[model samples]
Target: MQENERLARTFEEKRPRLHAVAHRMLGSSDEAEDAVQEAWIRLHRSDTDSVENLDGWLTTVVGRVCLDILRARSRREEFFEEHADPSAGPRSQEGADPEQAAMLADSVGLALMVVLDTLDPDERLAFVLHDTFAVPFADIASIIGRSPAATRQLASRARRRVHGASPLPDLRRQHKIVDAFLTAARNGEFERLLTLLAPDAAMRADDTAVRIGAAPLTQGARDVASVFSGGAEAARIALVDGSVGAVWQSKVRPIVVFRFTLEDGRITAIDLVAEPERLRELDVVVLDG
Candidate 1:
């Protein structure tokens, strides 16, 4: 085979993994494919011989593309909001581009996506590469244009953020918080709910939820607490994308999933997902009552 065909074939083989990395970093299949296609173009234009590992080379190129897109995205968040499907929680893998779906099966669920969205662009890139994908800090450093140590620090910071525990809340701690929250919600304990929520707590619900009477966004512990004080009577402790969350179901089908972001025993954010299509894709199971 000619050199160009050889490179093309090699890239084709690595495309699935590349798409996964891009999709995790960019959160959109369209953006992920664009990044992968750009990576292929760069590979074709560059010296393949100088690249020691073809897979690593392609990954870094895609990572760089994703970083650029993320940075640009931060500047144009309004554009994203304008374009985002408020009806959906996170983009689901069902009916996604086949290549992207194959990789998403490995564990790209809404829980992680919600946490990842809270990170800074650089922190997000480092964490996704080093933690989620296990790309070495050296390779990540090159992509983000930071020193390896600096890159490692970024992942460390992101790690803390994602866990929603700077001091680190244990499973027991998280369970206790959620249990308390459920109790407060069931009894319409407004003050009790406020106590369990952070001063700056916020709540976000998808379009389906908003249309059904939930606010699209609510800020302040008092405001968020008020909305939930008389609610959650039917919410049950469940595992949402592998974490302790509340899910309301009709028989066995989940109607709405609530994912919480907790810090220091206080609820910081509540991600209420009611989009049926997206809910169907979530891995949720009710905990034993």
Candidate 2:
């Protein structure tokens, strides 16, 4: 009974930080509270005799709980999109408590929350744990079932998407970077390609692109650079969705569009889009090389 009291005190001390971590990852106070409670329950059930860092252990537990919640939320959203009645009109936001919503918006900027929502479950966890909470990459990697390097890349990609989802302030500079990447890739200049990529750069392909033999996902600067080396001969520098990127055209129409997210003059993320519908949505204008 005495030991239980000590454990309770310790957990209470970590509650605020754990809640903050969950709130940042989930963007919902109620969900964050639930995740924290789940962590407490897990803590009670686990044996801590061998645990060296209880705080880190608890934070990892909370992170894993939040990740599971995010993935489940994604699955539910997908189901709703596929089966919900189109004529039902958008679901009412009435259930949310106005005061809580306002508090959340104030504490975590509404814009930031919206951007965080765009990240994948693992990416969100990695970014929040490593960047926001200062958790180590090794710990985050264990939770996300990835190597430390890959976890770092996930966080980097998420960071780029969160901060790069805006109009380029300098279009010419972006164009130059894209052009350099393409040139290096075409010339098989592996060293130059690596120089153009961020240390944790990543690449992803949509379903249609993967069907055409593009990798679904590639992480790390060396791996990503290798995939592009001796490639992209037919790709032309272009303005894809208002950002400098590249496109592969068949005749006069774009068949594949390469969307890039760059930061600090290094490529952070690359997305290959080949879905016909998605391709149509992009405002791609092939530029003169």
Q: After superposing candidate 1 on the true structure, give the runs of residues whose Cα lies further than 4 Å from its correct spot.
A: 78-107, 165-289
- Sequence-dependent TM-score of model 2: 0.57
Candidate whose lDDT is highest: 2
TM-score of each model, in listed order: 0.51, 0.57
Q: What is the C-alpha local distance difference test score of candidate 2?
A: 0.81
- RMSD, each candidate, Å? 12.2, 17.4
Q: What is the C-alpha lDDT of each candidate?
A: 0.78, 0.81
Tens digit of per-residue lDDT, candidate 2, span 101-157: 344336665456556767889999998899888999999999989999999999999
Q: Candidate 2: misplaced stretches above 4 Å?
A: 91-95, 167-289
- Model 2: ten consecutive residues of lowest lDDT: 86-95
Which pairs, if any, clash in model 2? none
lDDT tens readout by residue for model 1, 65-87: 99999898776765645786655
